[model samples]
Target: MSYKTIVVHLDTSARAQARLHLAIEIAKRHGAFLQGVFAVFAPNPRSFVVMAGTAEYYEEHETVRHEEHGALERLFEAELSRAHVDGEWIDETGNADDELPKYARRADLLIIGQDDPADPESFVADHFPENMVMSAGRPVLVVPYAGSFAHIGRRVMVAWDGSREATRAVHDALPLLKQSEQTTVVTISAAHGNVPGARPPGADIAATLTRHGVKVTTLDLPAAKDVATGEMLLARIDDIGADLVVMGGYGHTRWQELILGGVTRTMLSSMTVPVLMSH
Candidate 1:
């Protein structure tokens, strides 16, 4: 449950530096190895609109992608040298959604930049959190578009659903939770969904964590009035003054490479704190 290795998905977007800074900060704080991964989307031949005059321009633009990969490696190496942190750099060619998770499989935690919708080339445009959560089946620490995080586990909030995704997130977050100065398991539902005969049915989920030596609090939020679970979770996260929020990635497949998932899109749109998600 100790986080000694972290994989951060790097990209060539404007947000790249912010993401890099946060990852390095976390690695230093935890004494963890930083695995820097830059994902390149296989240029879509079909998506290119054939243009006679622009043919050369398009080819030149594409060439830059390759060179940019190399430049990123050099940049990260320089930065890591200054920080005195050992890290490996990788430039993987494929759909970031597919390739990033494969490399993330062995990491204690995965870090990704929260993409800006304004940027057409944002890697997060692929709805990666959904795929990463499902495929990587690990805790993902997502840095929001702006503020960076320091030591994440000092105080935390857990959004509990008792679903497999939520369960996986809890297990994946055990390392952080165990280190937290305080951890709260908050379950919001119009009605209780605990399994029958589960002890501390006041959402015994919180009690289970208490048994693990976590300074824990469980709140069965009855005001679960909102059908929008994402909003509820965010509101509660604010209430707790927690810097980190841990929850399951919730999604229902909308189409191939598309998910109209509730909480998935909600957090993507706006989140108040850093979120650690698992599918």
Candidate 2:
């Protein structure tokens, strides 16, 4: 489907310009309506933790929060001023991971930065992919902090798992796939040594893409590294010099703090190109 209303999850960090640039290009490429989103805590998440602090402390917290909101808005405004495409700005004050998807569930796509969680300052896991993907069920395009993508159609990579979420990510990314000069479907081990029948039905997928007139190529490789499939995909993306990588978002969280076997977490940390994914 063509993206008409794309929502980008903007991390309010000093280096957020790269994320904004990629989002602008995607929006223009699809002629899509776009919105820049920043997650915030409503009633403040810190209120629960900092209750015992002095009045002066709470005032400082509130001031800092207000300034953050303002800074985010201005940053986006500046980016949009340089962007050839036009879009709206959005800010939601609440627990970031919770607030984003809860309000913008039906958006055509979600774009966010892919930064490491261990850096003590990465936005990838720190923001809210876990909650957003599980709830929104919309594709998320994750870009590494050192972004360098301009247009996404030169060469494309699709990481296929044949699961429901993977299926969703692929279909959601079809618009870009169709526009790509070449597209490769890279699937991790389907058997996993456990289920001989675990592989995705391939001929049907090839037929489906053929119907779209997509220049599609398919390869199912054995799991080679200790790295998760998502990480493998991004590694291949860089190796292939791909402009865009498409894959399914695997895994979900129970409650708020726990996560399961999703490859998204790893991909986000190390990716260097633009990636399109759906939950």
Candidate 3:
């Protein structure tokens, strides 16, 4: 399957442009229809004190929101038009944590910025990326908040394990993998949860990807002393000069709270490149 429809999250964050740039590139590459979903944090008027000046406070807040919304819409339109990519803009004012996933579910892929706590403009909800990865049934490509990624999916790395989540991620990333110049499937002993005994770790997946026209190879990571699997994966990506990583987003929701797996948390916080994750 291909990415026929792609949804991208847009806001006033510093990395919003970077996210949009990559999204447009991906859309152009796949000849896909892009949807730019604009959703940002807005404080509820009821949360403010019921005072004489409350009306003024509410009015000013709306005015700023409208200005920013219009600006972002203009920018999105201009970029898409210049790139010759077909797309539409969607302005959303609801809670992002609940609303973004609804849009994501209807698209073939969702592109979003990595959570940057220091960037006050990007604060929609706590653990926003984590929540989206777990909640959005589609694949989620999370762009890093600090870097400029002009392109991606050239040299790809897949974090392979034998779990259902990992299997789903591999299938979800098949389109990208087939287009990548080179793809490496790395199996970290600590991260390979319940690998099938029928064949060696990463072998079956490598063979399947090869059949799908992906330039695929497998690597079994050597045991490391006191090194976390996430750290190892990051180092390997850098060493191989990979532009993108595909992996499973391991997490579960509990009472509306997300409890991310250890490796997933580490990658979300410290990833150096874009990651395409599926749950």
Highest lDDT scorer: 3
Ranked by lDDT from best down, the candidates are 3, 1, 2
lDDT of 1 by residue, 107-180 (tens): 88899867667765455436665567667756788877766565577889988777787788888888778878
TM-score of each: 0.83, 0.78, 0.92
| Candidate 1 Cα errors over 4 Å, as ranges | 45-49, 59-71, 191-203, 224-227, 252-261
Query: In angstroms, how far off is 181's CA in candidate 3?
Result: 0.6
How does each model score on lDDT?
Answer: 0.75, 0.68, 0.89
| Candidate ranking (TM-score, best to worst) | 3, 1, 2
- Higher-lDDT candidate of 1 and 2: 1
Backbone clashes for every candidate come to 0, 9, 0
In lDDT terms, how accurate is model 1?
A: 0.75
Tens digits of per-residue lDDT, candidate 2, 4-112, equal 8888776545446666777788888888878987753334445567556655666876687578667767867776777666788876646666667754576788876
- Worst lDDT run of 10 residues, candidate 1, spans 194-203
Question: Which model scores highest in TM-score?
Answer: 3
